[model samples]
Target: MFDCIDWVNLPTFFSMLVARSTIAPVLAAATETEPEAESSVVLAGVLLSLVAIYFASKIGGEICARINLPPVLGDLVGGVVVGISALNLLVFPDSGALGSDSLIMSILQSTSSLTPEALQVTFEAQSEVISVLSELGVVILLFEIGLESELSELIKYGPQAAIVAVVGVVLPFTLGTMGLIAFFGVATIPAIFAGAALTATSIGITAKVLAEIGRLSSKEGQIIIGAAVLDDVLGIIILAVVASLVKTGEIEVMNIIYLTISAGAFLVGTIVLGRLLGPYFVALVKELKTRGPLLISALIFAFLLSYVAAAIQLEAILGAFAAGLVLGETEIQEELEKQVIPISDMLVPIFFVVVGARTDLAVLDPTVPSNRAGLAIAAFLIVVAIVGKVVTGFTVFGQPDIKRLGIGVGMIPRGEVGLVFAGVGAASGVLSDSLQAAVIVMVILTTFIAPPWLRIVFNDSDRLETVQEE
Candidate 1:
């Protein structure tokens, strides 16, 4: 009978009659009853994963040094072993495509589920945040690379550097691209992906080798590093064009022509314009009275280049790399480096760990359905990747140079670039999931294995060159 009381007067009646509001206490009590441990547990796990990745990279990098591998290679493999696919993927199963009890698949699934769908969505959202963090990590990485570049040495060995870089990038790109067509019968999109992967020369390993032998400042060392930078710029542009074409399914003759002409032309234009404009821009910074302008200018140019590259259907990394080159040629280069280095030191390792965390360590078992194709492709691509670069080393325009070959071998590993391709290809659907796995494996192998192989090749070639001179 009391339920018939009028509700319409509740607001006015409460205001008139009540000395204090009851709503606040009721809301606080409800919140207090909710389980806060769930949120804490998830955050704690993410933090621990990040910490594990950090030490793994550092320890793995040291191991690489002892074994004569490029730390980049180690970082790449290390990341694959513990990445999103390996660690985080265990919690996810391609939307329940795999059985729950699969031994390898249960690693990430052990966390107690409060609710199935809610938990899955949370995991996916976490992955997305980590991916975004990786992007920021990349920016810091470039800053570090920019800092490592010694302009004085680059200028001294400029021609040799350009020559080596040119042959090194072009040959592997062509060979790898063609291999997709020849051996795999893969279409243009896939071929382009294979080619783009080859365009990168993992400098982390090369830089380490140079540092060890006291040649990091020598004629050979300077040229190799400089060219690797150029190769990165060009590779990124190619990646953009290829990705665009793949997405559009329109590989017209004009598209090919456009990609070819614009690639070199853009590089040339960027260099000429950047050099001519850099000094003036630095003067602007000087006039502005802001000591941080160099950093600002570098960042602006990097973004502008990224914008321009995307507008032309190229990747932003290409623009970032080009910006680094432009900055390398300026007096503010040193200043920019000083400003950016510490930031890189702190942030770049995070990017590397994030990268490691994203790598899906799950190999395509032959027993698994549709995995044989993936494994076969992975193996084929690995050989094509290695042989392609090694052969490119032998393509010198001058004398029979084993030293050049060794340098080319040293430049073979793909590192982040390959991952970018596999990721983009998979996301774009040009690469099937299995195909993506294959590509990732191929990328990991090339990145992890090439450094020590190159070291051996470099040593052998050094002896051969010495004998030839005698």
Candidate 2:
């Protein structure tokens, strides 16, 4: 009878065994008396998650390329796919999403590194560490965007670029905002969502389209690129303004004016100051010698502006984007390019995949009204996104020697940055799911459409070299 009772209480015995083993050190660590044990655990978990985000991002990118999509698409997909799997692996070693979690991987992980009594403490440490690591991943991703710009071309073509960017951003925003308010009968939040969708522009994607048709150096091409860059800066400001108005129920016109003025002022100031300080900044970075002071300093620079951007209600990426524009004109561009491009090339894909992954098509059920509404929104958006960019082809109004339309068409792809907007908006809850999908679909369509369209418009191969000489 006593033996039967013991058998019945086996689970209770195991529970106490597990609890007794983990409690003492955790209690000690919580009280901050066991500082060494706690630090060691937190440090290990953070290192593991960071390592995982990078490696998984790289693999996902390569795999995505094999399937004919942007490596960014892969990385984003990989982050979530890999992240979910990693989480499971952390919880249950044999979950079979992949091979057994490696011994090396386990050692680096606070959770798996612990034995007997420290298990729960290690797990608690890991959750916090993982969150931090993911935030680091987002930071690195934006920093990469800053490193990819070209300032000379951006400047030489500044006026037209500004015109196109402003036209592109302003028109779409106005149209989208009005369309929702009048046609859809949506409230201010949804109307803002529509304008946010209009702010989407993929600078990298547009450049590649022009290059594909060898029109990247055309008068129109330069104008499109320059304007698109500026357009991004302006668009972000507009987004901040709209977001602020939606949130606070006041569109303080003075505040809006001040925000706009500050953005322009920051751009002008950074360029002037950075030009004078460029040499010292570059030399200082070189002196730091693998300490990554330049990169770290750049991040601090990016974040400072990001905070400023956010304070006035803009996406932090916009601040980072402006910082990149200044940095591009500095003496450090080459070294910055050399050191950061690969990492950017790797992590950027992760940002893309996140966009695709967040788009759960199931939410738009084939048989439902929301699904129909989503499809309709996507179609209208596709037209607006394309027509709006195509009109930029006319920006070469004063310069007819260029294939302005070709450049305009080339400027169409939404690429990574556009996806970043889509992802950030969705993640931040500023956009409804239907709205998110509509914008992403429009971005993808524009990107895919431009390549073929560019071939048709810039059909002459000789003009490409001639444009270079002129």
Candidate 3:
């Protein structure tokens, strides 16, 4: 065998073995690095998404500010422009958009070695991250609103606010439900679901506008804010009941009672307990000598309460609001408010923009044969949506000087809350395509119109007040 082997080939054979050994480790290291590379791609996608969000927010807000409209509206418009409805830049999987549909995903694919399967996974993860950020943005917004609010004034107007909230729910639910049933010939369940959609009042949007106009501390503003809080509670209960009905074809009475009681108990308990512990909270913050002790401690308190709220089937924003109300009574309240502003400036716009982004304006196209019926139903819902909440202003008694119209107009935009209802109905398969489209149309118009309309009403009211004073 030794004689058969060529002496000249020995060195080459030995080199081939060495090359195989070296290549194995290289391949193994690359296989190990694959997951890490995927992670990098995911992070890159998120960074790009944030970039798009910030750009849209600033551009839209600036344009709106220049036009004498609410900058929040501009943020929303910016979101719409970049969203699936227009640019397909910031689409989400919840909207039935594929990874391949996003321009951002395409860029990632071209510049990197992301496979189709991995791209889908990354798209979902990235969307989820952005969505959570959006949710946090709103929670922070509501917390800021609570900080700016007067607890005593809110309590003073509590009864009136309760009445407003109740009337807002009952009137819209009754009229919207009955109108769909009688006028649109929609079935009972679907009509009820659609009616439920009409009852939502976007506190975040209304609060932002009011705060912008320096009306956040006004008597009317207090009433609107108070009512909006109660309305949110009621909306939760109603949504649960309706969703239950959709799934099981029957209402869960016991579940409804539990939700109502729990909601009431949680709100009252948080306020009472937080007030009692307010001084201690201040003292604790004073003891801490850290970079952001005050802000960090406050956010921790807010997040704890928020977690509790979510655990109990209530909205996390409610807990955050309660936490703000509690902390607002502390000595550090003013300083804390100052610290929170910058954070709010960074985060709050994300909420408004994401809301606008999620809204599919395509539903409003009457040129589509299928959308014709929806347009008609949408018209009816819009009329009810406006009138139902507008009349609630008149329901306020004992405050004759309060801006009743402003209060009503403040509640007009259904915003993200209305979209929740439409989404649930669509998911349940209870809503017809036309009916779902109709609900979406109503949401879009009400959301787009309310900010500007509220500004005009309040500005006019202010002018009238000046004239009367003169």
| Best candidate according to TM-score | 3
Query: What's the CA error at residue 134 for candidate 3, in Å?
Result: 0.4
TM-score of each: 0.68, 0.65, 0.92
- TM-score-superior candidate, 2 or 3: 3
Error of 3 at 231 (Å): 0.4
Clashing pairs in 3: none
lDDT of candidate 3 over 385-458, digit per residue (tens)? 99999999999999878889999999999999998999899888999999999999999999999999999999
| Whole-model lDDT values for every prediction | 0.63, 0.61, 0.92
- Model 3 TM-score, 2 decimals: 0.92
Clashing pairs in 1: 79-356, 83-357, 84-357, 84-358, 240-315
Better of 1 and 2 by lDDT: 1
Put the candidates in TM-score order, highest first: 3, 1, 2
Please identify model 3 stretches exceeding 4 Å from their true place: 1-37
Error of 2 at 222 (Å): 4.7
**Candidate 3 — what's its lDDT?**
0.92
205: Cα error in model 3, Å = 0.2
Worst 10 residues of 3 by lDDT: 31-40
